[model samples]
Target: MEIFRNKKTFTDYIERQKEMGKRIGFAPTMGALHQGHLSLYEAAQKENDLVISSIFVNPTQFNNPDDLEKYPHDTNRDLKLLENTGIVNAVYLPEVADLYPAGLKSKAYNFDGLENEMEGKSRPGHFDGVGTVVEELLRQVKPDNAYFGEKDFQQLAIIEKLVQQLKLPVKIHGVEIYREDNGLAMSSRNERLNAVQRDAGKVIHETLVKVNDWFRIITIAEINKRVKDIFDDQRGMTLEYFEIADEQTLKQTDFFYKDKNYRAFIVVNVGEVRLIDNMHLD
Candidate 1:
């Protein structure tokens, strides 16, 4: 696959491909390629004539400087994984300056209160950073369709809103959450966990499974308390937040509406490694 480091070169190439009438698919990510990320590529490839992706551990999206510093990066392995995909037509590796240019600053956005719940409430300015870098990537790539993982359900919702608010002409597709044998969601950050922590990580998904099972018979308030109680007793982990929210607005709700779509969102801090996952609660 062709690799373009220069922003204009990649943009020009995409433009040329568009002129040739090839439908473009994009999967933008930080450079820690895994099966979960590749799943997005597979999803894009099935629908588009060409598939492209970018590797930029966006500094803007990181609220904690330590997190910005600690976020994983293995360009060689990442590229090799992309190469192995065989379906990836091209790769874009943009420098911080290429995307940011001015400095490591994030542009502010109003996600219409969508940014004020769950992950947004925990990480200040996180969605703004997400909005800034994603807007830049979407504009530069300008693909007919962009793919995201449902693991980051909140982020996906915010990005869909971003596309609408910015009036970007691209469809957003959300792939299902990919997990490990232990049922822990696959993530680059998982590399940070040791064996025991990895075992402990299973609890996050385990709890979600219970949440899904209990949604039909239990009260939302009771489920919320039960989730909290599980993590409260879980060893070597902290439950950052477990929210049963409306699938669309993402607002945490104690009352489940009969006709509304609902999803369970969760975040857990395993030692220093933070992990997140979500499930469709029917």
Candidate 2:
């Protein structure tokens, strides 16, 4: 597969592809790829003639500098995996300056009500950064469809909203969240955890499931409190937020077990790693 590290080269490559009249499928990621990320490529490959994958660790989307610094990176390993896929047509490995140049302007797109809850509440200005970068990528790549992992359910929601609100000519499709055998959601940050912390990481999703199960009869407030209690009971886990909300609108609800179409989400800190996960009731 062709690798483009600069705009001129990447844009030229895309122009050539356009001349061939091939449909493009794009997947944007911040490196340290796992099975979850590969699943996105598989979806793209099945539906499009060409697959474009980007690996840039976005600095703007990161709320904590330390967290951003600690986020995993292994271009060599990632390339090996993508090469095995045999479906990736090109890989865009843009530099930080290329994505957001020195003294460059940054733009933010408001995701209406979806940008200020759960992960947004915990990481202020996070979605704005996400919107800025994603908008730029979509405009540049102009793919027929883009694949996003449902592990970041809220981020996917915001991107879908951005496309609709701005009328960007691209479809945003979400792949189901992938997890390890122990049930911890797969993430690049998982590499940061030591063996014991890795085991403790499972508690985050398990707690999400436990809290979601509680929604069957308890009030949202009670369920939220109970979710927090699990983290309180567990040592070294910091609860950021545990929320139950309407899946599409992301507005917090009193309770949702009866509706059977709501979503349960949680964001918490395990040592230095910040993790988030969500489950659909239906």
Number of the top-ranking candidate, with TM-score as the measure: 1
lDDT of 2: 0.84
Local accuracy of candidate 2 as per-residue lDDT tens digits, 124-193: 8888888878887887788999999999999999999999999999999999999987889998878888
lDDT measured at residue 126 in model 1 versus the true structure, 0 to 100:
90
The best candidate in terms of lDDT: 1
Off by over 4 Å in 1: none
* Candidate 2: stretches off by over 4 Å: 257-260
List CA RMSD, all candidates. 1.1, 2.0
Candidate lDDT (C-alpha), each = 0.91, 0.84
Tens digits of lDDT, candidate 1, 18-135: 8999999999999888999999999999999999999988776787889988887789999998999898999999988887878989998999999999987768899998888899
Q: All candidates' TM-scores?
A: 0.97, 0.92
Clashes of 1: 0
